[model samples]
Target: MTPPHPLAPAAPPVVPHVEVPTPRVPPPSSLSLPTPRRRGRGDDALPRPQSVVPGALAALAVSGACLALTLTAPAAPALLVAIVLGVVARAAHAVPASFERGLAWVGRRVLRTGVVLLGLQLSARDVLALGPPELGVLVVTVATTFSATLWLGRRLRVGRSLTLLVATGFSICGAAAVAAMSPVADAEDDDVATAVALVTLYGSVAILVVPVVARAARLSDRTAGLWAGMSVHEVAQVVAAAGAVSAAALSVAVVAKLARVVLLAPLVTAVGVVRRRGGARSGGAAVPVVPLFVIGFLVAVAVRTVGGVPDVAVPVVHGATTLALGAAMVGLGTQVHVARLARSGGRAVLLGAVATTVAMTVSLGGLLAVGALG
Candidate 1:
């Protein structure tokens, strides 16, 4: 050690040079922090269009087959055939979860659209031509059949939804009426399937039964047609039954059936209003008191009445409506379980038979009362 001068700037003690590492901050672009995804109202986690294709295609295929069958056979009810195919497919477990979104879309949106188009088939002149006497008879017949079926269904201890569906179907336009009433009633698919099945079964039977009875009663062709139109559950069945008599009968019968179809819009609106009121009281999701499609249906009817859609386009409109409805039926049918239906279907069968009898009896009696059978 050397002695240091007292006041001299003593050499600074040797200090080691230490390097301080600079804090390394990465650029924002290179930072891998996850930003939260903000979902829009439309992002409700629905299936992609590609994912929905398979089910939609299947339903459309089935509808096409049904339409072909009806066109070729002239006796097959396309909607009935579609639902049967759906039921068979369901029983075989052919429907997968992936099919759900598309099937649901078909069942709801497509069905409603079809129903709106259905109104295009009728004109005010066609409905009005039935005359007050005939129209009065029509009203009475529907009311009696509907009320009796409802009472009978209650006695049979049928579920309310099934009962309502059956009552509507049997009293009005068969499967079409069932479809219309389902949403208003908030019915299960099983109920709708059962109701439709019953309508098909009994309406088919009517095709055989009505012609035989008409002959036995020595009824005129026009009278037979009127009877078939007034009482039968479906348009196809009415056609088959009336056509067995004469071409003139067929014309009368179809017009009569169209008149019945006209009542559907009002009935749905009334039921929807009632259901909406009930839902409000129960704190349930509010049902549309008058569903927009129903308004569309009325508009379609008015359009047809005013000849807004030309007669040339009638076939096209009708074909499109049938296809849409057939597709919807296929979707609804897929939801039905045969095992479950079999277990509960017996009471429905009995109700259907009784309803058929009531419809026939009331309509015939009304015709006689009004002397319209001539």
Candidate 2:
């Protein structure tokens, strides 16, 4: 507002006072947050030979031993035998830290590859051939078992992480489900260990129990196999359980189990959403909408369904699947620390038992209803 001399330069215009936000510098801890180890799909680095060879060799040795044992005792499933030896070794501290990386690699990568190959054995047409009723049974069984396990876990006061892990494992694909769910759920290592142990214990027992129950119930081999596939925790467990009945049953069982395996991606995504909404932090890498291997599985299924695979390749693929899966089972077996599991708490064990029963009961009941409806 002051008058200025004509010789003076014109005054600059007054600028409005605008508050600029100071860029927030995160604390050092936040800036350098350590990434949690990812066991879920898409974390596929090949470990160093020094880190991988020892455990891989050990797993191969156990797989060979299991195979030899199965020849002498046809009733014993090689997969079951492999897991048992792994559990025994783990309980005895026979597995060293050196074997950890290799075993983890085999358990995740090799196991997933086997699962992908497993799809070659299935025909989507065959699955659809079951019509809506049988398919409905599979869906109902998975949902009911998952819900029942969650309910029982709450009633038993088990930790939410453990409960979620166990529920995912039992209602889906056993140890694989536990592995997939851990990161999304922000589960602790101890919770993971306990969940894996429970799934291993009950899933192993299921290998024996399911066949016996199927026999006692006088179910047809197909029906029995379907029940096993629907109810059993792991792919290996389902194979062992259904195989104990007959070759035909084993075929049916694998197809049925794969159907349930297909549900894993969506389920994991849904759980991740629920956790995020509940203000839970992810413990590891972001959850993949669909794991790479699961996509591979679907591709394989499509190939087989379309008759793109030659007949000569069938048995070779089957043999490879068996070998890869069998080796992975050895790694799974070693994760079971019986002593640690026992010391953890009885409530977890009880929850596992209830979950197992719920899976079996719901699957069998659904199968029966399907039969009636058919």
Q: Estimate each model's TM-score.
A: 0.84, 0.70
After superposition, candidate 1 runs with Cα above 4 Å error: 1-48, 279-283, 372-374
Predictions in order: lDDT: 0.84, 0.77
| Colliding residue pairs in candidate 2 | none
Per-residue lDDT tens digits for candidate 1, residues 1-374, read 98877988978899999999999999866778966444322212345677667788878888988998999997788988999888888899888888867776676667778888988887988987787888898888888988898899999999988998899999889877887877777777789888988999899999998889888988877778888988999888898999988898899999888988888877777777877777632124466677678788889999999999999999899889889989988988998888888887889899999999999999888887777444
- Please give the clash total of every predicted structure, in order: 0, 0
- Candidate that scores best on lDDT: 1
Task: Count backbone overlaps in model 1.
Answer: 0
Give, for candidate 2, the lowest lDDT window spanning 10 residues: 35-44
Model 1, residue 274: distance off in Å is 3.0
